[model samples]
Target: MKYIVVKLGGSTLEQLPPTFYKNIVELHQSKEWSPIIVHGGGPLISSLLKSLQIETQFINGLRVTDQNVLDIVEMVLSGSVNKQIVRHLISAKGNAFGISGVDGGLLNSQPVEGAKELGFVGEVVDVNTDMIKEIIQKGYIPVISPIGIDENGQRYNINGDIAASAIASALGANLCLISDIPGIYIEKDNIKHTLKNITKAEVEAMIEDGQIFGGMIPKVKAAIDGLVHDVPEVSIINGLEVDSLIAYCNGEEIGTKIVLNKESSYVK
Candidate 1:
């Protein structure tokens, strides 16, 4: 079976409409492709932290997850957002199971020792794809939360984008990142959407030209990483559009396709 890994950003999920969920249900019912969902809960976690009166900080756009903040991250990601995605998928008639990086030692990680201030923030060192494959084989979509456990058995908050990329690379599956905007734009305020089939070289040029900066930098990097790691292709599609995913997956020209230059000849 053709398998795809989708990473849904927390910002995109919060903005997702009912129609989007319905479309996902339809996609799940197709029986043509199997999908594994890795989701982020940054926005939700931030809100919860504020409600609990915790100060938040970021180092290089990654949250500096202190011990208290880590607690909130666990609660919101594994507890609320994970279950919500599962509930929505199940309601749409798709069999969905929610799991965390901590569950079954799915993702083993280590602290980013270079940054002393970012407490409990980790980078995924390894992933176990056996359980994921088993779940996919059973026709169940695995909804994953981006919470990793260190070798010392301490839970650490991981960046969702990194988590998704690691998982996709391990599974060697086509990866798609669903977000609120149409794929990476050449000019942020240009208003005219330019969905070019990009190569890693083009992405680097865009970054040098300041077109890709800030939040988009990491996202584009993740997509490029997937392409380089033999995943075949990775795409960035707008989550707000109900049929965006289906259109892209069907090669219907919906979003930006990031491909290695070696593979460009086959895209057309």
Candidate 2:
């Protein structure tokens, strides 16, 4: 069966319509493609951190997660965010099991290069593919929270995009980044046009030219990183559109597909 790893940003999850969840359930029930979800809860985490009067910081888009912040992060991600996604799936008549990277050591991680600055932030060292596969085999969609744990029992905050990329790589699945916008766009003569396809090199060039900026940088970077690690395909699509996820799986060309090489890209 074909597998697709869907990365749902916390910023967009709450705004996503019930039909989005229904489409996910439909995709899961289909004989062709199976859906696995990896989700983020940054907005909720930030709101909680703010309410608690805890100072938070970020460097290079990675949160500087101290012990206290890590506790809150885990609670929001593993507890609330993960279960919320599962509930959505269940409400749509889908069987979904929610788990964190810490569960069964699903994600083995180590401190990132700048861990001293970004405390408790980790990069995925390994993924428990067997455990994930077992969950899928049991007829349940795996809703994963991006929290990694090391051998020493220390949990780390992992970026949702990074975690999804790693999982997609491990499973050799297509990675779909669910975004609020239709796709990456470029401005020309005061008009913004969504790209049908983009290459890694082109993405880098766009970034260098300042055409792609802000939060989009991390998303494209994660897609490029996934391609480098052998994920067959990665696309950024708007979750708000009805059947967007299903359309993507059916190769309907609704979003910007990212590939490693120019030759691998379609001439759209």
Candidate 3:
């Protein structure tokens, strides 16, 4: 019953190496860790929209999806990216089943607070945890695409990180956010180094000091949210590295582990 939710960024999805797939297969076959993949296709979706002469817009990092855009999003995410991951895993001798939040109401959500401004963007309110757990227990790795739906059949595009966090939170599973970089970097003796373990307070202070900025903001924020939601573990790992996943599964720290708090010190 050891489950880990791996959130693959769009960049990782674009260049997921064969070793990565094989590693996932190994983890699944070993029965030590049940890995669930949640993936995004931002670049692919954007490219398709451009090719079709569609206008794409984003607000606060959330895509403003219209009806036509939603159609393409679903096609690229649930159809293309989802299957592609499954295909790669299957090719590596792994059993995988691709699905979306919209299918079987896996992620029931309502329009994000300001739906009028950011059309069709929803935040997950509920997750069908039982279904996902069942899929995993049945020996099928559940590869999820972050496309959610409301009760009235209105579909909304979800941020992949947020979607993964919600699912992991619901299942009380460990979450690994696959990032382009190795991990959180800190300057040590005039040289920058990655922090192996960190706490939310330390990360917040780093952000305040401008040490953590740019695209990494959302990731650290998501990690904090996962911790707040009672997820047992959360880490940011590099998807490009061949041994990252395996190393993590073996408990040989390969990324920045986000913990609820740091060790307390007694000030004399």
Which candidate leads the pack in TM-score?
Answer: 2
C-alpha lDDT values of all predictions: 0.81, 0.90, 0.87
lDDT of 2 by residue, 85-150 (tens): 999999999999999999999999999888889999988999999998899999999999999999
Best by lDDT: 2
Worst 10 residues of 1 by lDDT: 259-268
Model 1 Cα lDDT, one tens digit per residue, 1-268:
6778889999988788776666666666677777889998888888888888899977656788888888889989999999999998877777898999999889998886654888888878888899998887787889999899976789989888878888888888888899898887654344555665778887788778777776677678878877777777788889898778878778787677887774431111
Per-model TM-score versus the true fold? 0.90, 0.96, 0.91
Runs off by more than 4 Å, candidate 1: 188-191, 262-268
The candidate 3 region of ten consecutive residues with least summed lDDT is 259-268
What does the lDDT read for residue 203 in candidate 1?
Answer: 79
Task: Sort all candidates by lDDT, best to worst.
Answer: 2, 3, 1
Tell me the RMSD of model 3 versus the true structure: 3.0
Q: Which residue runs of candidate 2 sit more than 4 Å off their true CA positions?
A: 263-268
TM-score of 2: 0.96
